[model samples]
Target: MPATPNSFSVLSHPSLDQSGGGTLSSPVTRPVPLVESTDLLRGSKTVGIMHNGSLYRLQATKLGKLILTK
Candidate 1:
């Protein structure tokens, strides 16, 4: 199902906090932006992403998998 406008997926990463003394019990929640595959592909099977000074290729395979290459 598609996500609702107010709904999203969240990921948590655990980190060590020396200030709290062995405090890795609580995870840190960070919001990651979600993008649909169709939106990225936009009517094509491949798209280019420019990061830093390099270009990366994101391609959708025939088997419905994605590949990223530098």
Candidate 2:
């Protein structure tokens, strides 16, 4: 990844890498930041996130998967 982001984020994990089709890899010098969905939602099924002048909705699906949309 670039030292600084140039956009193109549609929900990607920090620990995931483009190599090998997005596999998890640990950083040698620093730990990745992690945030639990429950903590973010605070018991709600949906949450609104503001990013780059756009409002996005993050929803928890019935199958327990997360979906983010603008």
Candidate 3:
């Protein structure tokens, strides 16, 4: 079923802090898809993620698993 306005509002609203402080700010204001794993590994066994001027390797193993290495 599609998400209702009430449900969406609750999910997007701030929550009370359990630490007895105050309501915690909600960080997620909107939904966004960063990337899909299947899309990244499509037609390939390895993909790279660039960070801090470095390339990190994400590989699909023979056992049908994934590994990320710096």
Provide the TM-score for each candidate, comma-separated. Answer: 0.63, 0.59, 0.48
Decreasing TM-score order of the candidates = 1, 2, 3
In model 3, pairs of residues that clash are: none
Error of 1 at 49 (Å): 0.9
Q: Can you write out model 3's per-residue Cα lDDT over 10-62, one digit (the tens) per residue?
A: 33323333444455554555553345567898889999999899999999999
What pairs collide in candidate 1?
none
lDDT per residue for candidate 1 within 1-70, as digits (tens), equals 8878755654443333434555555554555566888899998999999999999999999999999999
Better of 1 and 3 by TM-score: 1
Query: What is the per-residue lDDT of model 2 for residues 23-45, given as tens digits with 9 covering 90 to 100?
Result: 54644344335577888889999
The 10-residue segment with the lowest total lDDT in model 1: 10-19
TM-score for predicted model 3 compared with the true structure: 0.48
